[model samples]
Target: MTVSAGSRTLEVKVLSAEGLTVDRKPVTKNVFVEIRAETLNCSTTSLGVADGARGSPSWNETLMVEIPPYARSITFDVKCKTSMGTKSVGIARIALSDFLGGIVPESSLQFLSYRLRNWEGRRNGIINFSVRVKSAMAPKYEPSVPVPMPALADRGSCGSQMRVPSGEQHNPRGVVTGIPVWWTNHSANP
Candidate 1:
């Protein structure tokens, strides 16, 4: 896949899951989640508890994923490992408008819950998570250190205000010229 240089980095926190079931039975062990943004690389969370404690499987893990700026949604695929093989539990798709839309600013944390659909497109469970855009691909224009413009500032004054000429010189005859005023270097005059 072609990756853009200005892709955004997402911090997706896989918080927990509730009411998850497969084949009409509650999930038991090695339950994990796979995150995807379109066709970009996928990130997976560590497996949850095996004993089916707390009435549900919980994986409070944070995953870092990079998504293209044009991606409109992300998918959360829940799966479980059985003695036979890895089984599909459910899938949850979250639209970009859900959190990345509206007046929300970048780097703002947005907590959300999405319903998971089983293989047959049936409601199976809910996935809870928080996501935030770490930063925009392009950095802001705020300079960390103050730039020193020695020629623009007066050494005698400690403030950052520009130094003005001591006095204004009037034309010899107070005559106005049709030539538009142009900038010239004072040092070049000498």
Candidate 2:
């Protein structure tokens, strides 16, 4: 499979969160934001935690992440730290297309707000953030060279081609324990 490259980077600023809850109880203080792309790469707030605020908390921090062209959305995991340990309040998935505003310019900031959903799929809170796409320079193109294909062995009525490596023995499973298997056959022939 060929992997395509992206042309821009996303700068995300996690502003704050409001009306958050954990297990039907209002969360007050020690709240932080965890932002992640659908691709699994993530970033967490590094500064002071939002503390002492019940239900509503403020962070006002910025996190920058590269946005691959194939990425469709980003997820935010909101949690609060307490004596009992950290508890997840809710998560928010924001589509890149919704805030990217079609064609991304050199540097454009977009303020957005989305509702947060708990693991049970219920509305739990709201998270505010700002996003922008940093334009990238066009890549220079070059001529490509095609690689030659390897030769294939002929198969008889058995419909299977076997290649035994030098100084290696094949187990009953047709695999050499310590050696790598470069070819495989789907035929029933032994």
Judging by lDDT against the true structure, name the best candidate: 1
TM-score of each: 0.67, 0.62
Q: Score candidate 2 by lDDT.
A: 0.67
Residue pair clashes in candidate 1 = none
RMSD of each: 17.5, 13.1
Instruction: Give per-residue CA lDDT, model 2, range 66-167, as digits (tens).
Output: 666556788899988878988788999888668664654536787889999998999998988888865542233332333333533433222233333322
Model 1 over residues 32-123: C-alpha lDDT tens digits? 99999897579999997643445678887998877775678899999998888998899988887777635787578888899999989999
lDDT of each: 0.73, 0.67
Error of 1 at 87 (Å): 1.0
For model 1, state the Cα shift of residue 55 in Å.
2.5
In model 2, which runs have C-alpha deviations exceeding 4 angstroms?
A: 1-4, 47-55, 101-106, 137-190
